[model samples]
Target: MKTNFLFTMLTGLLLFTACSEKPATTYTINGTIPDNSLDGKMIYIYNRDNNNLNIDSTVVTGTTFTFTGKMDTAAYCRIDASREYYVNFILENGTINLDLSKPVSPSGSPLNDEIARFFAAQDSMSDLIDSKRQEFMKQTEDKEERMKLQKDFFQNEWKPAYLAMLDGFFDRNLNNPIGGMALNYMDGYLSTDQIKAKLSLLSEPVRNTPSMQERLQRFDALEKTAEGKPFTDFTIETEDGNKVSLSDYVGKGKYTLVDFWASWCGPCRAETPVLAEVYNQYKNKGLEVLGVAVWDSPENTKKAIEELKITWPQILNAGEKPTKLYGINGIPHIILFGPDGTIIARDLRGDGLKAKVKEVIETK
Candidate 1:
């Protein structure tokens, strides 16, 4: 009996030691905004991976606040102080301090330190791009000269340098879950090979994440729908209880443009006049413009069409499925399909849109 009791005490001590050695799952955040103007204002914490916002909100009291919670992984989170002010850092199982002054950043965690370096490099590249763009815009008054500014700026300056910077950090933090955040910066800019290379930089487990899978799928869809390929066919139920198919408009012996837009999309609305001009100039010259409203409500779709005087044949309530099929992750995604239903150009914005339309219209 004494031997059994001694064994039980030893087992208890072993169990206690095991528990103590295990890593802590919960995280604590103590913040100081240092801006009294934000005193009593609400700060929202957003999970960058799955859902942005709707997680938690806390009130700032005298430039200080605290947040404590746990996450499944070393997920990245951004603190929203205002629309114009925010700071992003990894939410790991440790105390973190956020600085809200000019050049906002976070500290007190290893992931936060990595993110600081990453953000600094990104901000510098972005600032240089912005400065050059502003300088070019201010210097040029010629519409034709100004038209080439964006294309030139991105290809010549931003893409190479920005991607090189990413290559460095992604190489350094390949094992860290924060490395997954690099995917957010790459949209339509990176090619399949480049994207896959970056994805390979992430740890194996992270490569299997749902978000990563969706991104890969989107990239695949984009590749299949690339310019010079055959246009993808789609059909949607219109607001008036009629079925509208892409075949009915596109590939029926006319150059057809499908403007994938939503009512709530500001960029889409801004391009309304542009679309109107092109439709007017080219409709009589074998051009057809169709509006497919996705990621919007029926009421809003009708409201925008009426307000903007959108006379083009519109497919209302198109929703997300069509976008998923075409790999359109964002709004204002415009595609120009040839008479034989081959894609001529895609994602054409501003001057590129006008040029493409005019070029095709003049060709035939």
Candidate 2:
């Protein structure tokens, strides 16, 4: 009996030792590349959440490379062998296997597996849509009719399905990096209120991340500049080294068309002629057009103005100041301000721009 008791005690001690020696929570990436030329090359993993800084690196030994790190929380990162070859994945506590040979494949981790499933679903839907588009193109000979049908299919059918899938993804990852990533992608698809609802569902720690905080601030700015809200004033220095306030042009007893654009933006350039036409038609009849060059260098702005024949008074070198104030995410964002500086309409472009200006100026 004593011998049996001694054996049981020994077994318990062994079990305790085994449990105590277990490794702590950490992540490891086991990666492989098939190209023989890159056997001795360097592999880098960048933390995209933190200014895309290199968080870890390794030398490719033979055709394989490995990286291991302890993460307090999950982060979005990318593994790059070169600019041409990179795969973005969530770095979490688990072993992740990546094959960067023919196509990038990330597996063997929970979040990575989820990402694979998400992408597969997206691709399948995209393929289905493309097939429908091709079939419709064959049947519909009229160019305008084909384009209209395609637009309806994409908007009414495919987009809702895509958004629903994304909603499921976000719902599954409300407290993780994946949720934050999902929110970032939903900006163009979802309305501001919808995004706000999704963001509110996240935990405090996830919502307070730098990227998420920036999204929150942008939403606030959007609210401040919604249609009918008074225009927010800001100042920027022009290419001529003169300081100018948006107030200098806006709220000066005339309807002002404020264009927040960049020199490198194609759509902005295309819309310039439309703006010039409107200005010429109505400048003598209570209209003023102001060009605020944003997200471009002074040299490029001046060159674009000369090439595009933009004779309107321009505020150059504005950078991100005006965009942030107005929550303008894309270039060619044009706002029509009332004579007293109240925002009349926004997001004007093409014929719609001309129509809005004409309606207001002619009636005045």
Candidate 3:
């Protein structure tokens, strides 16, 4: 995005004298369509939030098109030329200059600039994997050979490099809106400690933002159960009004697998059969599987278990205590506990659960 001629002149004069600190207060997007291919295309600026489409649009009249609007806050906007592909830009109150035939990086909005940097980082990440995959493909005609090459590259190299890049980016940009935006993207990629450490590095202004604060709270919840930490204890009521504590189920002289799930959760439901198989195979092998149903009624929990034929011991109507204790924000938060009651691993599912159970219980 490019600043208006008047605004740019005023900004330059202000910066020259170091006298004014006012900001640009409107948004302008200038586009160069460049060919008859898109001359009749109806371009749209889509706002992802509120499920809004074409909050603004322009029909290409010739080789160029432009859009101008007022905005109180900066957000990500998609320039949709067609369904298959689109360009993303930060919608800020400033002029954004673009040549559709060239790169989509816009200049005026600082938020947009930061967003562009983050995206470039992402593209670089993808490019590295693509390069490795292509190199492997060129050397091998076997389908399985190419598959292993791609898998090895991603699992061994992509994650560590991408995580290190993210760590540096998050560390460097923790004082602003960009830092706030980056937190949501850290899920599943950063470890519990990495998330906590990086989040703490964020400046107060960014950390104080409501969303950031909420994310911090969530990180707080999960970090308490970090792998290798002792599992916190909690109790739940059974259908017969008996209070069954976690100590009764876990922390025994066996590896305990706590399956935090809900009856309505589809993924959790799908994982029941896997749980059943693992439980059947390992129940007597110093491995115990415990089900804790949360956010679902005792009736439904019982019904689902019966229908699914899950014979494992379950704590119904477990509610939020287990989640809060475990710092779990999502369902199917499986935690593997050592016999001494320390948390061994978390978020494992399906084959991961079975493999981990075998690795720990059988291999020992």
Candidate 4:
């Protein structure tokens, strides 16, 4: 009778353990699009926190589509039918119901619900401003008048409301995937210092994301060479196999205009004539224009110089060395350095370049 009791106790313990075991975590995404235009479109899911990697895709049949998968951790993901129509949501281990017809309407997950509301508020602001712009465009045939109306609306209404929404969203969601996504959006609108300030407010889990790490590195590079900071010098090998350093021209005596460009870049080529014009106007005074050819071969650089009539001194075959040092992601990044090598202005383009050179030189 005692042996039977022991057996019964062991069986009871096994049953309890089996009941307490946790189930495998997974996610289900049930999406519907009422837009007939997107009935046969292919929908894609990208892991935004993971360098925008395309992790899953499916074709829409009729009015609905579904995606199911498991992830060890929740990530910020985006669903796109096309570039113009996309929605961002937290991909957690739960069922998510999404309506792709609207800007943001994901539901059924805690984080996704919050993200949806946040983006909905943002869409309202965008829609209102768009409506105002459309009305003004209809009223005015003059380009300048239309531009003025849009600019005034942006400064008075749109920017302040947008910033407030962004601030509130970041504050409320700093510890979640929503905060990570917000930081990515802030990249274009905020300065490096501003982004760093926001970064400090984020929780460790959010800050540790891949996109955040890349932003941190970019901010570091930008800060090291920001305006009013002294120039960071780099050496380049010329076409004649001679070495030239940026220190050779900058910080000597005259104000220097540095152009970081590539031979294959259309905008870079387009801006060369403007640079030449600026050089002619200011070289006799206290200005020097130096061209640093990046991400191009010596042959192409030389051919471009001859074809474009670029008379300025050039450092060829610089590759990506200079671009990395200055945090330059795109070519044709122009910088104006003070007489003492401090960066006076950056990203100068078109008539603004000429005006800035004029202002500084005339002041000198």
Can you write out model 3's per-residue Cα lDDT over 1-364, one digit (the tens) per residue? 1123323322221221121546788888877755756776788887643244557888776777888888765555677774433567767777786656544465556666666667666666677667777899898999998898777766666665665555555655565555655665677776767777777777775566556666666677676878988888898877788898999978888898889999899999988888888888988888888999989999999899888988889888989888877778888888899999999999999888888888998778
Give the per-residue lDDT of model 2 (tens digit) for 1-364: 1323323433321221112344449888898776666788888887777777788888888878889988887777787786555687878778988877523357777777766665555565677678878988898999999989888877777676666666667777887777777677778898999999989999887887777887889899999999999999999975567789999999999999999998899999999999999999999999999999999998999899999999899898898989998888898999999999999999999999999999998887
Q: Candidate 3: which pairs clash?
A: 1-95, 1-96, 1-97, 2-95, 2-96, 2-97, 221-327
lDDT agreement of model 1 with the native: 0.77
lDDT of 1 by residue, 87-155 (tens): 777778877888766334787776776777677666666776677778878989876787587667677
The count of backbone overlaps in candidate 2 is: 0
What would the per-residue lDDT of candidate 4 be over residues 1-364, giving only the tens digit for each residue?
A: 1323323433321221112334438888888876656777788888888888987888888878888888776788888786556677788877888887665778877777777766666666667678888899899999999999888877765665566566667777788788766666666677777888999999887888887777687778888999999999998766567789999999998999999998899999999989999999989999999999999998999999999989999988889888888888887999999999999999999999999999999987
lDDT of model 1, residue 228: 90
TM-score-superior candidate, 1 or 3: 1
Q: How accurate locally is residue 302 in candidate 1, as Cα lDDT from 0 to 100?
A: 91
Residue ranges of candidate 1 with Cα displaced over 4 Å: 1-26, 33-45, 53-63, 69-72, 80-86, 99-104, 132-159, 240-242, 354-364
Per-model clash counts, in order, read: 0, 0, 7, 0
Query: What stretches of model 3 exceed 4 Å from their correct place?
Result: 1-21, 24-108, 116-144, 155-157, 160-172, 183-187, 218-223, 236-245, 252-254, 262-270, 295-307, 317-320, 329-331, 338-340, 349-352, 359-364
> lDDT at 138 for candidate 2?
100
Q: Which candidate's TM-score is highest?
A: 2
Per-prediction TM-score to the true structure, in the order listed: 0.75, 0.87, 0.59, 0.70
